[model samples]
Target: MAGLTLSQASRALGKSKSTLNRAIKTGRLSATRNEDGTFSINPAELYRAFPEPSRNTLPERPKEPDRTTVPDDLGSRISLLQQLLEREREAVADLKEDRDRWRQQATSLLANQEAAPAAPPLVKRHRWWPF
Candidate 1:
């Protein structure tokens, strides 16, 4: 039969006084309008209405994560990769020059072999007439 004051409701229910006042103001909980314009709540009714106060709590703030990236490190890594690509390109060009030199010499030798004369063709001639 005890009518708890606003602060008492906050302590007993483990809620903020402002939160309880809001609930009462928002028509969620029944309260007694006092003679001096104050308010009171039935403790039993509150316990029955909210058996578990934990259920009414707002969600906790999430902990900040430790994940972060450095933009300067990424830029330096890209510069290193580009330098390696340019060196590989120079090596490929030098190998291509060596291959072209070998191909030209082979083409010259084949041309000389074909330019030498071939053996003359053999021919046979015979004639028979019954006129």
Candidate 2:
């Protein structure tokens, strides 16, 4: 006879493996052990043991809000982000300009120092000692 494994029987009957095992142990349902020591239950025997529940008998769950709806404050958030980005860009440009001006001033000062002449060494005259 055709049969279903314990896992298949559990899925069909909406019951757990342990529950079905208990039922078999209590002699409520019949199953045969396979060569691999696994139980195979006949589908007819399973239904005879536990009838399927009626459809639409379960309570309906509360519905969640749809994800497709756009948030009301999205436009304002985008504008705020854009303003922040512009401020950051302006600050970076100002920093770059200041850095260039300082670099030019340093270069000019170095060049002028190099072009200037070196000071002459001081000459020292030693007076002869009269004996």
Candidate 3:
């Protein structure tokens, strides 16, 4: 029977190669091994194992309004951009605060370690002679 190689089947089914391998390993799908040690799977079997989503099953997305329908005022555009910039600046401040906190914690930990007494090296007793 006509069939597709593993790569071809993966593309057709929108699945990863590992997923197909797992399906074959679990006996949910069957594939033939080529002489060169590559797997070839029947397209029908791939579809059976991983059915494509039906067109009718997918929810329809709302259409976007036409660009010409929207107002193109310069002040409105500037306000929107300013709002985005403010949000990004706030995000940067938050990140900087977190970094400073972590830095303080790490330095405090290091200070505490340095203040503590050092542990003595272990001394090993040598045997008088080998048995």
lDDT of 3 at 80: 95
Q: Which has the greatest lDDT?
A: 2
Give the whole-model CA lDDT for all candidates, comma-separated: 0.80, 0.86, 0.83
Q: Across residues 84-113, which tens digit of lDDT does each residue of candidate 1 receive?
A: 999999999999999999999999999998
Candidate 2 has its poorest 10 consecutive residues by lDDT at 55-64
Question: lDDT tens digits, residues 1-131, model 3?
Answer: 87788889888877899999999999999999999998989887887878775732434344467632333354477799999999999999999999999999999999999999999988997889976
Model 3 pairs in collision: none
State the local distance difference test value for candidate 1: 0.80
- lDDT string, candidate 2, 1-131, tens digits: 77999999999988999999999999999999999998999988998888876632343334447744334466467789999999999999999999999999999999999999987888877669754
Model 1 TM-score relative to the real fold: 0.38
Q: TM-score of every model? A: 0.38, 0.41, 0.40
The residue pairs in collision within model 2 are none
TM-score of 3: 0.40
RMSD in angstroms, all models?
24.8, 19.8, 12.9
lDDT of 1 at 109: 94
User: In model 1, which regions exceed 4 Å deviation?
Assistant: 53-131
lDDT: the better of candidates 2 and 3: 2
